[model samples]
Target: MRALVFPAILVLVMAVIGHVLTLHLVPSVIMGTAMNRLAAQGAALHSFRLAPRTTPQTQLVVRPSPDLAYSICAYHLRGPQPLRIRAAAYDDYGSISFFDARTNNFATIRIEETAPDSSGPDILLRGPAGGEPDGLFDGHDLKSPTPRGLILIRRLAPTQQAYDRVKAIASADVCALSSSAGTISE
Candidate 1:
């Protein structure tokens, strides 16, 4: 009985250690893999690039969806620069999401949420440490807590025709770093 008790306790300790290690390592591993994939593809910071259509060979991101056209803009806040993303309002459903280096989603906006009369599909992203832009309304901007992150744009494309249309829209999507003169509020 004493021997059995000792072995059981040892097993429990090992399990706990394993669980804690996994908790710490999984997210880092996933984020690192994603960044590596992006680099291999020659993806540049603050530029919108349409992802290749989902295929068996595609492995850049998990769970590639054939029904959705996807684009991504990876950014590094080296200059602590502000980024502006703009897309024309379209009939098809779409969304833009921002993820930090650790894979935390800092912000997301859907097409329906931004009316045609509203900000016109324009969004400003700034570092958390950066001051708010002058004369901009609250909902038009978001702050990223991390220096490095990604902006993902997804559009529903249920058919070949829809795919073509969505692809065009995604291609036209803009992600650019704002000039220093324009980044800060006066």
Candidate 2:
């Protein structure tokens, strides 16, 4: 019974450690897998007319337009590696997100905002492998406890026709919303 108890305790301790380690590592594992996927995607995206540049090993900064201030700087979210995407915009609340040229997908995070760190102007677009963008938006253009704005992303529509295609998609979504609202009113 004593020997059994010792082994059981040892097993329990190992299990606890394993769970703790997994919890800490899950985000990394997920990000890595995503990066691998993105790397394959980026290879295809190079054809798009985006000036994809690798996230430089050194940090880069984008100064605000004088005192106008921005909720987010679209450039910082660019990359630690070469990232290819159609067009990117600073959404309503100002989160810099973008569309992937390869997969025409979108992604975002707290890419930047109020009182951000001066350390990194990281990359957001991942390679076929995952990329981590600078998670800071250093400057407050809004009130207290800032909002995490949506970083609207779209595949780079370099031409009029490509733009039209994206525009149509947007119009469709907007139309759907408006139609739903109208029906709800009735």
Most accurate candidate by lDDT: 1
- Candidate 2 structure quality by residue, lDDT tens digits, 42-155: 422222212122123311223212211112112111222323222222222233343332222254433233234332123323334223333342221111111111123324
Model 2 residue 78 CA deviation (Å) reads: 15
lDDT of 1 at 142: 83
lDDT of each: 0.76, 0.31
Residue 120, model 2: lDDT of: 16
Residue-level error in angstroms, candidate 2, position 178? 42
Count of clashes in candidate 2: 27
Task: State candidate 1's TM-score.
Answer: 0.79
After best superposition, candidate 2 residue 23: deviation in angstroms?
1.4
The candidate 2 region of ten consecutive residues with least summed lDDT is: 173-182
lDDT of 1 by residue, 65-118 (tens): 888877888887765567877764557788888998778987888866777665
TM-score of each: 0.79, 0.33
